[model samples]
Target: MVNITINGKIVQAEEGEMLLSVIRRLKIDVPALCHHEAVEPLGACRLCMVEITKEDWNGWSKFVTSCLYPVEPDLIVLTHSDQVNEIRRTIMDLYLARHPNSPEIQKLAEEYGVLKTSYEVQVDGDNCILCGICTRICDAMGFHAISLVGRGHGKTVAPPLDEPPPDCTGCLSCALNCPTNFIEFSDQGNKRTIWKKDFEMLACVKCGATTITREFAEFLSRNRDIPFEYFETCDACHRKETSLSMGRIAAWTKEAQS
Candidate 1:
């Protein structure tokens, strides 16, 4: 256990844990977004910036992303210093200028006491707030069906050229992974047939058996597109994999054969 001092108080942490994890473990005050232990830590938001001062270190330091920053023995960290707070507030303001209707960003701004920004609030047709959390999650989870496109102020998260992304398994992983709730699956989408709601990713199981409200086989057949060969398995498939590797696939097979 390393005795890391946060604002002069010694706190202990195990190896490989981040400073944000350490602070949370110590019940210290820190701010964060897009920081979930269950998912990979991407330092995109820069909202969890902290001021870290070590024993051997000189001068105050600003850290943009605490989720990825590590804490070591004898480490000294200051979570909320004047400089870090100002930068965070500025970032928040810029985000607000772009997305005034975003509840998530507004709540964070309120926490930091950011009243408002001088820049005009622009509204895009899409529900995305451009946090990059959704796209990042898809990539981290090995579902590279979507991406952020364009550049500078014109960036948008979507499939390339607004075409139906081939990698999409109708899993609703994009909708599930999104932060702003931008995508709403429905029976209607003009880009392609697979964009329809009935073709969305259906959950079954990890095993190659079972039926549910949405099945990959059904989706794949309807879309006339099956980019990946091994899109089998349902949520409950993992638990029953050891036994009966094959089951009353007879019913489905007959149905399939017909």
Candidate 2:
């Protein structure tokens, strides 16, 4: 057992615990995006960076992502700091721009004293946040159906070949595990959304949200090999995608040229 000061309060934690995990275990509630309890620490999101001081280490820790940092004996940890807040705010802004209307992001922003950003992505009450929490959590379930695809600004959750991951086993673990309803699923931990086809599903085009039959998505990918992770069509715009695909087919006869 090692004793350390956190936020100026002395606290005792295990010798080799990750700083982030130790903080959460102590009920510190640090903000997290890429950190998960089940998977190897990826540290991609860089959300849980912390400020620390200790006998072994002094000065700021810079932006060391807490999700991957090992705790040091006698270390003083500050989970929240003005610098941390600024970086976190910027991260939230980027997420908002991409997803725009994710309730989870919105809630996080509100908690950090950031009510709005200079740019707000269009909010249609049905936007997928694309935060990656669901995908990360899916690792815990051993079902890798949904995942982050592409790179940088163009990244998104996808299956395989942009098609649904075949080994999905129809588990909607992603949706049930998602902090935001960006992905589709029926029951939590049910391996059905990753499999099946020909489902009666309803989607919201603006937000790309699914209102019914998330399992149907698996049908398209697992059965047809089409990347059907995103919304096919909302109940209101079901014909739009089809019409666009089919184009304008008018049957006005050949006029009266005859």
Candidate 3:
């Protein structure tokens, strides 16, 4: 366990635990995006920056991303100091400049009192804040289906070549992990398309229910050596079938006694 002072209150945190996790544990108010507990911290949003003063420092404090920074002994942290609030407002302004119409961005702007931005708004019908959460989660899933492309003014997240790559398995992890809801999805009949890549849907043989994407099923079967018979039944039908089989065995045992 490590002891650190957060907003002048001493708190105990597990060794090597992230500062953001500790801050959240302390119930300290801190705004953050591009942070998911299940996925590794990217620290791309910079909205969770906190001012920290080292024990040996000569009254000098430095700002660091709370999501990636770990707790240590004798560390003095400020969650919402003047410096921290200033930095957060500036970062939110930059995000608003790029995504003016986003409710999430606008909400944060309202909270931080950021009414306007000096930077020129880039109007390209894009609402992505470029937090990279979608791309990071996709890479973590081992699909590497989507990623942030280009640089500077041209930087944007998209599939490779701005078209769906064959590597995408239609996992929908990217769309699910997207904080800004930038990823689009379309489902029509047996086909489901996301990012311009269409995937066939697998249906349960018994219930005729759409089970999952054919690409996802194939990927799982190929990687885990799962049998085709397992995919033939959907989750609900499989549970029902298992219950019925168990009941039949119990009935046979009762009949044998008679």
Candidate 4:
């Protein structure tokens, strides 16, 4: 454990843990767009920048991204100092210029008092901020389907060869984890389509309701060692079965006691 001071409050945090995690645990509002607990921290979004210093550093301090900076003993962190807020405001201003159409970006920028960007707005720009959260989450799921292609302003997340990803099972991990909601997919009846690839949706045998994609269920069953038949039922039916089984057990116990 390491003792750290945040906003004049001394707190104990696990050594080597990221400062952003500690700040969040303390209920401090630090806006971070590219961070997800399911994957390793990528300091792509500079919104979580904070000022830090140590008593032995001769009063000199430096700004660091909290999501990637690990906590150290006697570390002094200022999450919303004047310099930190200025940095965040600048980043938000740029974001507003680049993603003017994105509601998420607009709301966050408004919080930082960036109602209008000083830079020229890209009116035709897509909402993608290029934070790489979607690509990172897709990679963490063990499917190298989508990736950031090109360089500089031309960079974008796309399937391999600019075609439908063969390895994608319509898992929706990339689309769901995207902070900007840039990825789009559609579901119609028993058909699910994402990345221009169509997948057959799995239907519950007991309730006839749609569940996940069949390919995802099979992948889970094969890799996670779960029974394939378990995916045949939807979550509601499974809960119903579990309740019935528990009720029967209780009745059996009562009868035996009598």
Q: Which candidate has the top score in TM-score?
A: 4
Q: After superposition, how far is residue 201 of candidate 4 from its true place, in Å?
A: 1.1
Instruction: Indicate whether candidate 1 or candidate 4 has the larger lDDT.
Output: 4
List, in order, the clash count of every candidate structure.
10, 11, 0, 0
- Weakest lDDT window of 10 consecutive positions for candidate 1: 188-197
TM-scores for all candidates: the values are 0.68, 0.64, 0.89, 0.96
RMSD of 2: 17.7
Q: Which sections of candidate 3 miss by over 4 Å?
A: 252-258
Alpha-carbon local distance difference test for all models:
0.66, 0.66, 0.87, 0.93
RMSD of every candidate to native, in Å, equals: 8.7, 17.7, 2.3, 1.3
Estimate, for each residue in 110-164, the C-alpha lDDT of model 3 and write its tens digit: 8999988778987774778788888888887788887889999788888888877
Worst lDDT 10-window in candidate 3: 121-130
Q: On residues 1-258, what C-alpha lDDT tens digit does candidate 4 reach at each position?
A: 879999999999999999999999999999999999999998999999999999999989999999999999999999999999999999999998899998988899889898999999887899888889888888888887889999998988899888999889898988888888899999899999999999999999988888899999998999899999999999999999999999999999999999
Tens digits of per-residue lDDT for model 1, 1-258: 778777678777886788888888877767666666667787877877877766556664556477888766777787877888898899888878877777777787888898786577776634466667767766765657678899876788877567777666565555656655566665332121333334533334443343322444555555667643334555455446634445556667888999
Candidate 4 has which clashing residue pairs, if any?
A: none
The true-versus-predicted C-alpha distance at residue 64 of model 1, in Å, is: 3.6
lDDT of 1: 0.66
lDDT digits (tens) for residues 1-258 of candidate 2: 888777888878777778888788878888886666766777766678887665645464666777787877777777788887888888877767666667787898888876777675655434555557767766655566667788865677777676646556544556666666556554422223332322344446465555545554665566668776444556556566667655533323334343
Question: Model 2, stretches more than 4 Å misplaced?
Answer: 55-61, 120-132, 137-140, 186-258
